[model samples]
Target: MDRPKPCDLVLTLSLSRGRYGVRFAQDPAEVLAAQSLRHRAFFSRTGQSNASALDVDAFDSTARHVIIFDLASADLVACYRVQFLEGAEIAQAYSAQFYDLTALADFPGILMELGRFCLHPEHHDPDILRLAWAAMAHLVDQAGVSLLFGCSSFLGADPLRHAAAIGHLSARIAPPDRLARAKTADRVALNAFAGMGTAAEAMAGTPALLRTYLGMGAWVSDHAVVDRTMDTVHVLTGVEIAKIPPARAKALRQIVTDCLGYNNTVSAMH
Candidate 1:
């Protein structure tokens, strides 16, 4: 998984709602297309230096990329990178660049490293996002993913405005096991930062994606770290597939079923 390569998109589902569709990156051209969209949604806005007009990265080759496009505009609207982790070689995943993940070494089965989740700035409505999420649920079920993890971020690399959001997460959400605790790096104690002895309700300040993860029983790192290159402060986040929230799980399963006619062998995840 360390070499320069192209990724495979296993399957794609188009929404019956008619405005969007989700597909796996099937070829280099599609990968480049998604990269260009990433540049527009991320690098271009951050003013960071890039190797090309497209936001290309080494992980593009090994990860399964989910691409969401607007049918009317025939343009990419959102995308996510999911890397399949095998054995104890998680350092090969993108989350490793932000946190010391030696604690997750013993995690069993397939661990999906979710990253570079992007949504075009203009298309931030809930409907399109639903399709994207449905696609993610399908991926989780299809891959038989046991664990889902990645870096959850806040804009501008500042911890001030987001003190409440990240703080609340750290205070309320603990991973299923401490085995996944960080081995290094500085982290913020959200409750301490927000001066809250318990979880603070700062849903307004939290990113939609992070909120979704939290609602699905995901947990975050102890503190946030500033990523100068990405111009954001981020915390490592993880979700156990079996532990996804019941209501949210039903919605996700409905999405997969309605959009792709997916069977229930995937169970609530379908």
Candidate 2:
């Protein structure tokens, strides 16, 4: 699929110093290497982890993998797997294990699942995040994806600490149509944090990640789930690209463009 056009000048300036590039894995070795980097970032392991390094589930074979390499260092810095659900591939999507498929039965257009997102710990430069989003925009444009959905996770199993943040999210952002309404499995429940409000002051201490999503017009599900494998609690979040706020969308596009130029070459040392 054709990628999105490069971002504007400001975004270019932000990522210009680094040799960064993103591409779909064309071979098994690249896929494995992407997996290895995921293992390192997600499990705190080097090279590979016997207990958790091989985190591939039923989704690996069907999903398209995007890997970012630091050309100067020749190291994989970021990666994500995207699964398109439509036509022949619809029956094999991976998120079915966590979400109820019945809720999505009436959606009229194509849907894509963004999952297994991970980045190397040392490469947490904000520019990398921008580049990843740029790549995502490119992918969405190419696939003609109308809606993007996935489970955005918090770092630990505790939802109490994040209650104020989650409550703030629930009160502000509205979920998609009924088909996309958030529902938790029986194992998890939505925790209510009393006195939470939508005021900026009330949400001042929310996690940056959730804040980012809210800024992008994303809506949270009704409840949260405990993901034993990742040892975290997560809420379902979905965004309709066309419905994204105009100003924020423009800002995202600009940021992504700036980061692309920086990612044009990879670092040899990562």
Candidate 3:
């Protein structure tokens, strides 16, 4: 299989009528900024506070870090890392460490795994999420990525609190039985969450990123693995690029187009 070429995803979106831009992390300091945000977003709720804390792991070296910056103030607001792989390289994927991906071993197409997705704890502007997806769309189109998969995390490690939201995914968007079986000993079957929570409560409790995945016709694994280290529960989520809804694809592409136009205009000025 051929490897993907270097991505040229440059998004400078006018989010919330404010300046926010997306680009690959250019240096160690920028990568550290992304790690620092992940540490805050992932640990603050657990009462952990270390100003020097960073969420670093072996995967950092292999993945391309995507960072979103508030251009107006030069603050790094959101970040996620993507690793491109062919089915032959599946074992190297970060998500492979948590879930059983044997079902996808013969996928026969380019796959992208998005991990460590987080936003600044204090920055809650919804448009940041939109821009994130738009950025992913840009890369997906450029790389000819057939599948986008990742661990879509719920904030806490306990399953009960997220039962309803988990149930909603289990009941409505579970992946085919052949995919992503539980590999972790601490996994909770989706059946445990089945019929557990109200639809309203479920939607309210579901993480925004997972909700975005569902909206784009993504599906989740049959169980969630508990990660006490991160204090979260997450299920393997996958979106077949070809299966994304037509209207949703159009909307995402429009954002990508707008950002590309902005990037080109800026390039000409330079």
The alpha-carbon lDDT assigned to residue 102 of candidate 2 equals 52
Off by over 4 Å in 2: 1-17, 45-52, 87-91, 172-176, 179-188, 194-209, 256-270
The Cα RMSD of model 3 versus the native structure comes to 3.7
lDDT of 3: 0.80
lDDT of candidate 3 over 1-270, digit per residue (tens): 654343333323232223667777877888888888899888888888488999999999988988877766768889999988876578888888888888887876788999999898888887677678778988888777898999999988999989999887876555465378777899888877788878999999999888888998988898899999999999899898899999999999998876655532111000
Best by TM-score: 3
**Which 10 consecutive positions of candidate 3 have the poorest summed lDDT?**
261-270
The predicted structure with the larger TM-score, 1 or 3, is: 3
lDDT-based ranking, best first?
Answer: 3, 1, 2
Better of 1 and 2 by lDDT: 1
Best by lDDT: 3
Candidate 2: Cα lDDT at 196: 60
* Model 1 per-residue lDDT tens digits across residues 63-105: 7777777655657778888887755678787888766777787
CA displacement after TM-score superposition, residue 88 of candidate 1 (Å): 0.3
Q: How do the predictions measure up, each by TM-score?
A: 0.83, 0.78, 0.90
What are the per-residue Cα lDDT tens digits for candidate 2 across 35-151? 877777666632235533556666788677887776656677888888766533433556556665455555556677787788887777765676677777766665667778777
Q: Judged by lDDT against the true structure, how good is candidate 1? A: 0.71
> What lDDT does the true structure give each of the candidates?
0.71, 0.64, 0.80
